[model samples]
Target: MTIYLLRRLFLLGTVLLGLSIFAFSLGYLFPGDPLQNFSGLRYLDDSTREQLTLAYRLDGSYLQQYLAFIQRLWHGDWGLSLASQQPLLTEIRQVLPATLELTSYALLVSFFVGIPLGILAAIKPDGVIGKAISAIAITGYSLPIFWWGLLLIMVFAVGLGWFPSGGRLGVLYEIPPQTGFMLVDILLSDVSYRQAALQDALRHLLLPTLALATFPTTVMIRFVRDAMLDVWEQSYIKTAKAKGLSRLQVLYRHGLRNALLPVIRQIGLQFSTLITLAMLTEVIFSWPGIGRWLIDSIYQRNFPAIQAGLMIISVLVITVNMLTEILHTFFNPLARKR
Candidate 1:
């Protein structure tokens, strides 16, 4: 097991190294003046241009600039934002937790709801519940995220107004940011209307979480349903049934564990999609997260922020996949035996 983990860790390092190269090259791959918007003018005086160039290391050759970037990165110095002039890491620290919080709630919604629906659907493939589950999965899989988000906004945000249209908190609660996560920050806050603040935060999260969860929940259902079917027909499942185990025991105890391997793998595979959806969802809902922050950075032509967001997002996805692989391998004894 130790050897297996060590090997996977080595592979993870190699993957991250390759990803870093790809991510770093993105700065040069796109056609843009990283310093063009520095002064927000079509043309600049030579002195201003020179200062901008030197400030951004444009005076160096591409190789030299790349080397400098690598050196800075090695020393944990993520570059300053071209737009705000703040450190990129500092901006990420402010925004990433919001994204993480949003994604966490969405995953919770998907996991809690989808797994049971999937297990039931798999157990009763020909029944009414199974058919309904299938329909939901199909509907969710077919909907475009942008359209879905808009539809949600129209229904929940505009028509009913049960949830707030956007933003992390109601302006009424002036809770100072303790953690970047609003939900956590709310709990830590000692405001007089603390309960109201907590409720408001949750209300704000509802629409966006539902919108972001739609696709992944459907995917999870399908994965679970399919995996359960495959596991149901396994010899051990039949043996457990033959032993007169209750239906629930035979299924949950003997079948669900083996069935979960693929579902666990899908959880990792789905993370990138979650990030992508979160971007669109953030835009639609005006939620403060790295996704929306990246969008704004792109609009402002903040090259450092853009590059940093990409690198951080790519590394996050890669790391999640690596961890998922480790969990998948660790859980499957047959794989460990090999």
Candidate 2:
């Protein structure tokens, strides 16, 4: 197992290295001088602009710049964003947690809501409940998240006044920054602070969470339903039924357990995709996260920030894939044997 893990980790590293090169090169290849935007903002004379270019190591051969970028990466310096004039790592660190929190909440919502609905649908494949579940799943999957978020804000926040329209917390709430998660910070703080912060955080998170969760939840439900139906048809399920086990008992203990392996893999893949989706949702909602930050950087042609964001995302994707592979092996021992 250790050997397998190490081998996978090495492969992940290589893949990330290649991804970094590709992302960085693409950013570099964009038309126009990358320093053009900086020219207007910095108000530097020609000599000074040249000096700044040299300072940023931009006045170099493309290969040289690429090599230096990789060397700096090795030393943990992701370069400074020309727009923000901050270390790319610092910018990324500030926003990554928010995106992660959003994705985590979405995944939790998907699992809890989707899996049960799927199981129920499978158990009664032709019943009203199953038909309703299928209809909802299809609609949810077809709807765009941005549209869903806007509708949710309109109905829940604007129309009913049940939730906050946007932001991580209310301006009035005093949330201590612990681990960059508002809810966790609240829980760890004093009661007065905790109460106000928790309420604001939860209220603010509701719409975005629901919008982000919709597609994944729909996908999970469909996948789970299919898996359950497949497993239900297997001979072992028939044997369980022949032993006079109740339908519900057989469904839960035998059917659901075997059906979950595929769902688990799908969940892992969905999580990787969620990171990307969270960025889009964050922008629409004015939520502070890596996604919003990356979009801003892209518009400004801030290569460092873009590179850092893409690299971080690639790392997340690779990590999730590795985790899913391990989980697949664990659930299906024949995978390990092969």
Candidate 3:
């Protein structure tokens, strides 16, 4: 197990190295001035341009700039945003937790809700419940995320007025940012209307979470349903039934236990993708997350922010995939044996 983990860690390092190169090269690959934010302005003079270029090493050859950028990266310098004039790293620290919080809520809903629905779909494939479950799954899978998000906001937020249209908190609640997670920050806050704030936060959370979870929940259902069917026909499952185990035990204990390998794989695979999806969801909901922040930076042509965002997001996805493999090996002893 130790050897396996060490090998996996080494592979992870290699993958991150390759991804970092790609992330950095992506800016150069596209046609745009890295310093375009300062290109045409009466207030900006030649000496200022030279200093800015020198500071960013943008005046140097591509190879030198890349090397310098990497060297600065090693020293924990991510650079400043051309748009906000804030350190890109500082902005990432502020925004990443919000995204994580949003994604976490979506993932929880998907995992807990989808598994049982999936099992039911598999167990009673010909029944009314199974057909309904399949229809829901298909509907979820077919809907475009952006479209779904807008539909959700319009229906749930506008028509019903059941949830907030966008943003993480109501304007009335001024919870001091403690952890960057709204739900957590609300609790940590000592405001008089703390309970109201908490409720408001959850209300703000509901629509966006539902929109983000819809697709992944459907995916989880399909994965579990297929796995459950494959497990159902296994010899051990039949034997468990033959031994007079309760239907629930025979199905959940014997069937779900073995069938979970694929589901585990799906969980890991889905998480990395959820980040990408969260970007669009964040925009639609006007949530304060890295995704929306990146979108704004892109629109503003903030070179530093854009470059840093690419590197950070690429690393985050790769790291998630690596952690998924570690989880996969942990769950499936057969993988360790192999």
Candidate 4:
């Protein structure tokens, strides 16, 4: 297992390195000068723009800039954003946790809710419950996340006034930031602040989480149902039944375990995809996260921030995939042998 982990780590490193290069090259290839976006400001002039370009090493040849960027990366300098003129890492640190929180909650919802519905659907494939589950799954799969988020806002926030419309917390609450996670930050703060912040965060989280989770939940439901059906038809399941195992025991112990392998893999892939979706959701909701920051940087042509965000996201996705591969191998010994 140690050897396997090391191999996976190496592969992950290679994938990240390749992705960083690609992302950097793509950013470099984007049209329009970063300085031009700031050109209209009276304080900025040609000399200042030249200095800024030189400082960022953008004035150099493409090969030279790429080499310098790589060198900076190796030394743990991710460069400064043209927009904020702050270190890219600093900006990312502020936003990454919010995005993670959103994605993590969404994943939890998908697994706990979707998987159970799937199991129930599979258990009574021809029943009313199964058809209802199938209909909901299809609708969820078809709904665009932005549209879902807006619809949720209209119903829950605008219409019913059950939740705040947007932002991480209510304006009345003041919670000190410890972790970037609003829920955790609130809990760690004063009691008076905690209650309102927690409530506000959860209310704000609901729509975004549901929006982020919709497609993945639907996909998981279908996959889990199919996998369970396949596993139920296997000889081991039949043996368990012939041995007079209770139906629940045969389903849960014998069937579900075997069925989960595919679901596990899908969950892993969805988790990675959630990061990207979280960005879009964050933008739509005006929530602060890496995605929001990335979009801002893109508009400002902040190369360093864009590169750093993309590199970090790419590394994270690769790591998640590697971990999933490891988990799959562990769960099915035959996978490792192959």
Q: Which 10-residue window in model 1 sums to the lowest lDDT?
A: 34-43
Error of 1 at 276 (Å): 1.2
State each model's C-alpha RMSD to the native.
Answer: 3.1, 2.9, 2.8, 3.3
lDDT of 4: 0.80
Against the unseen true structure, what C-alpha lDDT does each candidate score?
A: 0.84, 0.82, 0.83, 0.80
**What would the per-residue lDDT of candidate 3 be over residues 1-338, giving only the tens digit for each residue?**
89989998999889877776765675566455545432212244678778767865787787777777677778777766766666667899999998999999999999999998999999898899998999999999999999999999889989998998999998887988888999888888888999999999999999999999999999999888888888898899889989999989897687878888767677667888799999999999999999999999889867667777878888887787778788888888888899
Model 4: residue 48 alpha-carbon error in angstroms: 9.4
Model 3, position 80, has a per-residue lDDT of 66
Q: Model 3, stretches more than 4 Å misplaced?
A: 30-65
What number of clashing residue pairs does each candidate have, in the order they appear?
0, 0, 0, 0
Q: Which 10 consecutive positions of candidate 2 have the poorest summed lDDT?
A: 34-43
User: Which tens-of-lDDT digit does each residue in 7-31 have in candidate 4?
Assistant: 8888877887778678657653655
State in Å the error of residue 53, model 2. 8.3
Instruction: Report the lDDT tens digits of candidate 2 across residue range 1-338.
Output: 67887888888878977887786575446554555422223345788778757755687887766676677677777666778676777777788888888999999999999999999899898999999999999999999888888999899889999998889988887766778776787788876666767878898998899899999999999999999999999999999999999998998789977898777678678998798789879987889998999899889876656667788988887888788888887787666777
After the best TM-score superposition of candidate 4, give how far the Cα of residue 169 lies from its true spot, in angstroms: 0.4
lDDT of model 4 at position 332: 85
TM-score of structure candidate 2:
0.89
